[model samples]
Target: MADTEHSSKNVTEVSTDQQSNQSSKVEFSEEEEMLITMVYNLVGERWSLIAGRIPGRTAEEIEKYWNSRHSTSE
Candidate 1:
């Protein structure tokens, strides 16, 4: 009984961790993409300001996304 309970607890903990990991992924909607573009054109590379205009997005996340999409790395 004790081993079974412990195993179930571990499984529950793992499930919770997976949920958190999934939530951490950043998914931008079409509107968000358009907003980012318009905002970027207005204020190039000012990540914090751009982030402020978008809800639920951190400056670091916005900056990373912009760099990944637009960085001139060839």
Candidate 2:
């Protein structure tokens, strides 16, 4: 019983780590970057609007990407 519980816990931890690693890969194509920049300049840090202008990305992802790059500049 203890072995089963411990193995289950280990499996859960590995799955969680894998999920995080998978989601952390936020790649932007050259076109996506250009559109992101255009929308950002036009809208001025309004992440949802910027993201809407560039499909295939959510507001949260846009915000995270923008903040990671430009948050220090602000």
Tens digit of per-residue lDDT, candidate 1, span 2-72 = 99999999999999999977755678899998999999999998999999999899998888777777889
Candidate 1: residue pairs that collide: none
42 in model 1: Cα distance from truth in Å? 0.5
| Local accuracy by lDDT, each model | 0.89, 0.84
- Output the lDDT of residue 21, model 1: 76
TM-score of each: 0.64, 0.75
Worst-scoring 10-residue span by lDDT in model 1: 19-28
lDDT of 2 by residue, 1-74 (tens): 99999999999999999998877678888888888888888888788888887778998888877777677652
* Winning candidate number (TM-score): 2
Clashing pairs in 2: none
Candidate 2, residue 64: lDDT: 76
What global local distance difference test value does model 2 have? 0.84
